[model samples]
Target: MSVSIDISGLSHERIHVVPSPLAELGMALHALSEPGHHPGLQGWATAVSTRLDPCLADRLCEADFLWRSTFSDVFAPFAGLPGQSTLPGATLAEELDQLDKLTDEQFVDAALEFTCQSTYSEPDRNLLADPAVQRRALDLAAARGPQQVKFTQRLLDEPPVVRAWLRKLLEDCDEAFFADTWARLSHQLAADARLKTDLLRRKGLAEALKALSGAVSLDESEQLITVDKITTGRTTTGSGGLVLVPTSLGWPHVMVLHRKGWQACITYPISAPGLTAPPTVEQLTRRMAALAHPVRMRLCRHLARGSYTTSELADAHGMTAPEISRHLSVLKKADLITTRRRGRYVQHQLDISVVSRLGSDFIEGVLR
Candidate 1:
């Protein structure tokens, strides 16, 4: 549920605040591939999709395995590809240049390792050298999905071909849309990094880590910085220490890469300018209307206590399951609630933050 970064005996100098173009590009690609998750960029994503060349789109489709997965270290310079050294590059060209230095064996190894992360629990890079191991890895990849299996096969059988294809795809993406997008966002990204650096200097690591994102927390007593994540792991910040990369497009998702032989890196979403603008009148109206009903208001009060399944809510409220589900749907549409699966039940809970912000959002909407 959390990633604990041990910072015992680590100097402040080891913790860096750097802006990465490749990491931003990786996030952009992810935003492009899964537009629904990034509601803020829906307009931009739609425009980019319309302008994309058919051939380039096909190539992007082929490489969905890389961007679709949350573990996109292949595009990050700090978490360099397997057998490759880490480099904090300022520009995309510099990052790609670092990637270009990878040998055929290293490229294949990196792809294999990335695939293994999505499929197997324990990934042994040493075994990747064995042809039998590669075959088994391919089988595991097959179980994940078609895109993963195809990419893995190409990576293993045609390393050079895949390497060239990947390079070209990145280049084409830059030319198509990412170049302009980065140009517009780079200033904000750099400013965020500078702000983080200043915070680290003035407030110390505890405050600085806490300011990274809502999902991050610091425990001074334990000397650990814990990140709220689905998969849990712990890594000690050794001599390499920690690198914090600020990304604009990586909103709502904080990714931490702490693999062996690399400095632990956390790529977090920056408080993007203009991106987190106040809600519109329509949004405020919808949210207000969602809680205006007597039944829904009572439901919100109950959900504020804890999460409940539709059946549980129905039982508690003395209502049918269908009636509870309809009200829950209205709240969900208004972004007043969130849901998660717990075994066979789908538990729904009030989005307290959204509810709490309604008053300010309504005032801002009316005034604006």
Candidate 2:
């Protein structure tokens, strides 16, 4: 199965155009940047709590904080939490200490116990492999795909379904849609609850939702709505009521980009037994995979610093234009990077913003 979110070998720029549905799911799963207002998680939390083992669920929560910190500190600008740094030069022992001192033995034992049980969780096993499950997930994907694609086309294309949904949500001070959304997402969550839980936990679902809700509420309280273009992952918007975009694979919930940040919640759909895995190298050619090469990695690093034409990239790396073009071609095919045509030049730049959001979220959280 071709995983929509797969960009393993793609350049960062091309990765931006990742199917909006997949990107939306990715964003929603990690949209836990707020609390009660965390429509995404709250929508699916009940399902998660129901399907996932209590101990595993708790461990997942702990792991979320760990990964969120890791991504936020490593990536910088895209930090999801915002203002947070990776766990500073502290050892595992220290980490246990800062929170509540635990003996090295206790921490190690706890870690092993968590790793063992969660492996068998449903989502980890790939829910889409089951034909029935896959069909249901695909159905939801089909239902929402056209709408999401339309929304992605441009600001004006925002679908009525989304607009109406948002209007209802915004008018209801308590965000009643959250409950319905969660219930709707429950089917998918149940089918892939184990996997969804793992990914959400890994993405720091609990913390991100908490942080996001706080940001949205505070933004609303201060009337901080409407900012310049909001850019997340590779998607950018000028101005519009945020809409929760759905993924073809069916997500645990829905997520929408608001002027300030985001609004999200769990969405239950009928459990589909099968959906393909996230994108992978096996899905791309060896040439396309070259984007993950060392030379390519460095080139991306440079371009991410600032846009540079092919010639400039070659000169900086002491390589020929042809060589740079070869690398750029591979990167472009993988959707990891993109080139914009200037008056007299085409410039290249990195495109992996999904991971960057994780980084951004962390920074925001820690800084505050």
Candidate 3:
């Protein structure tokens, strides 16, 4: 439950806590370890919106659970903070409604909740206070399990106790152990991206090993971390990254390092999972390039889910009606999404088939 660490080299300066409310939700759910609590982060918010609150939809979607998990996996360990549990009744209701509806707005609202603003801005506070935002969140709550509202309210009221644990983890461990922990944490994060439910199951660990097996660094420098060794510790509440110590039975493991007096553990070999094939640097370059325009990337993710009317998609992204139409037109030209006119509305879907063809011909198209 505790460890000592000294990480003078790994300062918190390099650690950039995720600023998105949706990511906080992912971290929160991952912390809770419940499965399918909220639809995978990104487009699910938008998709959920279509189902839960038609009036409160927007097109400004965050990365889906999978994509957001990729980032959270990297950041959660370093950013681990103490957990406090407190939730306002109205806020909890709103959060659940967002989850049930899966509105793009849900992702924004959730990300905003835990995003490290450091100083609260009046504009930001006002946005949150908007009656439309509140109504939509309430609607989302209505769509979830019976106790969702209560649970959410409790969470908003207090941060979890895990932050103190992370601080303790950092203070007790050394640099080498810290690095190993980082790797373990990274692997756990990748597997988690594909994991649909929030439940921290043994299967998630198994999948992580499988992902690492593709490029196991047998190099003596990368410590030989056995599968059994990684599974021993109960993962902390907020971040999905595991915490372990050398055990006599089965396998050997150790705690990751953090700064002196800090209880945090750092892990390495950071990477994402569920790539159809291992990506080359070139492929990664292209993917990054594709995401240069935030709006375009958002559109691609929306299409990945299924065909939706332009209006339907627009509501999810938080865009003006005309803005949505313009983006769709651009995407169509890029061959990323295909559209069909359904009388009053034009529906669009991801052109994965085309993307596959493009990749085969050295013509990379987007939609990861």
Leading candidate by lDDT: 1
Between candidates 2 and 3, name the one with more favorable TM-score.
3
lDDT of 1 by residue, 137-206 (tens): 7765654456677788777777778777887889889999999999999999889888888999999987
Query: Across residues 1-368, which tens digit of lDDT does each residue of candidate 3 receive?
Result: 12222222332222221122222333332312221222222242343334433222121121122222122222222222222111111222232332333223222333332221111112243323466544544443333322334333332332232223222322232131323333434344434433412221434333433443332121223222232221122222222222311111101012132221112332322222121333444554554455457787777665653456666566666688798887777667555677776444466776644343334334333333
Ranking by lDDT: 1, 3, 2
TM-score of each: 0.71, 0.23, 0.28
lDDT of 1 at 11: 84
**TM-score, cand. 1 vs. native:** 0.71
The numbered model that scores best in TM-score is 1
**After aligning candidate 1 to the native by TM-score, how far in Å is the CA of 214 from where it should be?**
1.8
lDDT by residue for model 2 (1-368), tens: 00011112222121111112223222232333222223334545455345554554454443342121111111111211222211211122222122223222222212221111111123233332344543433332232233322322221223334334322322231132233443455354334434443443455333322322222221323222221211122122222111212232232222222211211111222222222223333323332355459998777655543345787677667899999999888877766676786445576766534213333344444554
Off by over 4 Å in 2: 1-277, 280-288, 354-368
Q: Determine which window of 10 residues in candidate 1 has minimal summed lDDT.
A: 114-123
Ordered list by TM-score, greatest first? 1, 3, 2
Backbone clashes in candidate 1 total 0
